[model samples]
Target: MEPLRTENLRPLDVSENLWDRIFTVAPLVIIGTVEGNSYDLAPKHMATPLGFGNYFGFVCTPRHCTYRNIEKSGEFTVSFPKPDQVVETSLSATPRSGCSDKATDVLQNLSVLQATTVKAPVIAGAYLYLECELFRIIEGFDDYGLITGKIRAAHVDKDYLKVSEVDEREQLMKNPLLAYIAQGRYAKISETFNFPFPKDFKK
Candidate 1:
């Protein structure tokens, strides 16, 4: 075989570019609810997918408040925002940014639920909610802490299911979620092309 020609393989920008790509492919919205206050951060920097097949979950490493809370409480929640809630979703990811206030201003009326296992609150209007318990906490070399949450429960909204014929595609179709990219930048699923999974996908 001929020597492989070098192409786009270049140094990854750890901050803006590298971190963003991880969140782009499979976005995860993490809600860190502690005390009476709820602070959310949808991490753009995540580890490779772990767990069993389609039932797998993306890794999340928190460097600030969320990490502190999860380290203390050993529990957290991940909620999928609805399509219409993309703006709010993006705002929630902002760490101490004023955008969070703006997003909350819009979603002030949104309902929140108490987590069964964790102190963190769940978005009542979210498409899906995962109640997670801290399984492992790996301290990274950088200013980040890798948190592995074992999903104890997965809650799907009732309104999202009108019949026995539940189609994840159809449910997600209506709520095309938001994704993190760079410094305070976001992208919508509408702009990206999607493909269906194979029939033999492991659950």
Candidate 2:
């Protein structure tokens, strides 16, 4: 095969928003929390499991209710929506009206269930649910805060489970997952391939 041509890149202005240019594909999950007497669900794309432990973290802005609610209550739930539940996930991000409660409105429209270890709610038809307690909140990132949580309990749909006896690709095709492309895009991921590790790789 011919070697691909490469172009030397030059530094651009820092004022340009570079997140979209990075093209990171992240899992789209709805973060559920308790706000006053109501429940709040917000969709977050910049989330990932921290290290190999039971810690999960997401980037959140202080202006959002999710951050405030978590700060107040110290607990939250995470729902990993399936491809078919994209509408519900998007609905959770709807802005609140000045006169009415947004959380009440969202719960009335979407299907949710009470979490086991947390006081928050989780989307009912989601592929996975995680109940978490706030571990730490790291600030000093300008306007964004990194909220880390200690996962207390987790639940997964049997259909989406990777069984040792079953083929992984077949299971994924049966239950397509939802992915978020940064900068206002989403993908339904059903196809996958195993990573080709070099021979004699050490653990």
Candidate 3:
């Protein structure tokens, strides 16, 4: 590889948003939280595992009900939707109106199931589900906050599970995954390639 000159690089304005200028691939999962009498499902793109353990977290704001509900209930559910359920996942982000329940309207189009460990609901038809208990909420990220949880229980659909007997590439081709391409885009990942790791690499 040849070293390139810095003259070709374009500096971006940091005062405004920088993320929208580029595309990022992220996992899209529906976070479920319990409200007063019902549940609220919100699809979060800026979510990830805290570590290699049973910990999960997502970015949220105080203005959203999902964030406040998790504060009160101390529990939440995560549902990894399949590519076919993209519409339902998108509907879960319906904004709440004045004195109206946004989840109620969206739930009409989505099917939900009770979480086994957490006092929340998981979107039905999702390939993977996780029930989590509140771990901690770290504030002070501008208007956003990190809501983390300790996974109490997890479940996965058989089709999406990997086995020693089955080839990973073939398995993935048979069951595609749903991915959120940041900047308001989504994709169904069907084909994949094995990462070329260095010899004796360890996690």
Candidate 4:
């Protein structure tokens, strides 16, 4: 006869690294810079960008005012940060912990572009800026939310993106994609692959 060991089980209350767990499962993470009625509630909201081509957007919990502002205002700017700006990008995720009143003070100071379609601002240093309008908002259980926006405009840096010169090897050696492993820690992703999924199974 053998006895099962209950000692192997530790108290499971909360996830040790929820962000890391989600990051591994999620294929991509897009930094969202927003402006709402009360920025005090959530200084900045950064989440994974999910949707189809030309209609790209993000899915986030509805609790935050950014979701409501986008629902009412119908626009937002998805900014992709530069590798060197990782420090400032990570600071955007930190809750209002400093003495700054405006949550976006640092973002603004980073030399960003003013969004035309929306009141929100886009990171000037970003290689691409996706301007979007709220197309649909899917609500579920407590705090669980899914919001989709239609890509209104795309501002890309002509210096970086090019077809003939653009290659995986070039992007690896020259370009660095910002990746969030944990909450604050970031890594430069030099590896990339192109895997197109079925139209019906789009994220």
Candidate 5:
């Protein structure tokens, strides 16, 4: 066999936060929380399940209302919007006026439902919903903070649920999933392939 060529490799600078420079696919979720008399919904792409168990987390900044709301209420909700609902997800990020309440302005234009376990609201028509209680907040990372949550309740749309007889890929093709490509881009995930894990592998 011929030796692999590596002469073209070059060093890259890391001064500008390399993660933002790379193109990565991540789940885009709308985070919901209660703000006094109204509710707030914001789109977050830097979020994921903390581990295999029922824990979730997302990166937040102190400047955002989400961080303060979660701190005040001790709970929040996550809604996974479908591919078709991307417009609504984007709308949630609309900037609010200084004199007006952002939660009131944003919630007035969205379809939402009250969460069962938390005081937060969940987006209607979302494929999945997770009601979470504030677990811990790790701050002091420059300006961003890691907000961890313990999932208290979860809900999923019936159509997106897995079934023994149904082919997962086929179902996904019919109802494509939504993905966020970092750097202000989005994608509709309609095709997928099974990973060929080594034999004797166990979950």
Candidate 6:
């Protein structure tokens, strides 16, 4: 191989969030929690399955009510919104004001469904929903911490369900998944390809 371009890359500042320097594909999910007598919904991109098991984790700051609420209630619901529900997902991030829960106000406008196993609500029309109970909270990551939960129950929309008889690619093509491009961007992923791996690869 020839020599690579050394000057093409620029150094990033450590003081600021380095994530702003580049784009990353992440699953965008809405975290729902009980806030006192009311309910709260917040969209989180830095969320994922903790492992192959029935566990989920998300990054959140102490300043957010979602963290405090989950800390108190010990339960939360994760909703995987569809590509068309991006606007609804964005609305969930609405901030709260003193004596005025603007975010919950946004919730009133959206269709909300109650989870059978959890006390929190799940955003309706989402492809997937996970009802989780707080498993553990690992704090001390600067102002943010990782909140892990044990999935109590899960749900999937029928239209998006996988069928062995159906082509996976075609199934996705008909029901594209939503993706979040960090720092204010979104994508509708319909087309996909299988990853090639060495023979006898196992996870």
Candidate 2 structure quality by residue, lDDT tens digits, 96-179: 753136888898889999999889999999989999999999997889999999999999999988779999988898888999
Ranking of predictions according to TM-score: 3, 6, 5, 2, 4, 1
Steric clash pairs (candidate 3): none
Model 4: C-alpha RMSD to truth?
6.3
lDDT against the true structure, per candidate, is 0.58, 0.90, 0.91, 0.58, 0.90, 0.91
TM per candidate comes to: 0.64, 0.91, 0.95, 0.67, 0.92, 0.93
Indicate the worst ten consecutive residues by lDDT in candidate 3: 95-104
Q: lDDT at 189 for candidate 1?
A: 62
Better of 2 and 5 by TM-score: 5
lDDT of 6 at 123: 91
Better of 1 and 5 by TM-score: 5
User: In model 1, what lDDT does residue 20 have?
Assistant: 42
lDDT per residue, candidate 6, 91-122, as tens digits?
A: 88876673237545876788898889988889
The Cα error of candidate 3 at residue 107, in Å, is: 2.0
- Expressed as tens digits, the lDDT of each residue in 1-203 for candidate 4 is 88867787545436463444444422233334454432321223345456436665455666555565676667777777767866656555555543234455655545555777766676557777777887777777356566677777777776557677568667655776666554445677777677777778944
Tens digit of per-residue lDDT, candidate 3, span 9-32: 988899989889988999999999
* Two-way TM-score contest, 4 vs 5, winner: 5
- Candidate 6 residue spans exceeding 4 A from truth: 1-7, 98-100
Lowest lDDT block of 10, candidate 1: 98-107
Top candidate by TM-score: 3
Residues 1-203, candidate 5, lDDT per residue (tens digit)?
99967699555576668766678999999999988878889999989999899999999998898999999999999999999898999989988763136777677888899999898899999999999999999998789999999999999988889999999999888878899999799999999888999999987
Where does candidate 6 clash, by residue pair?
none
The C-alpha local distance difference test score for the whole of candidate 6 amounts to 0.91
User: Clash pairs of candidate 2?
Assistant: none
Which residue runs does candidate 2 get wrong by more than 4 Å?
Answer: 1-11, 97-100, 200-203
* True-structure RMSD, every candidate: 5.4, 3.1, 1.8, 6.3, 2.5, 2.1
lDDT, candidate 5, at 192: 87
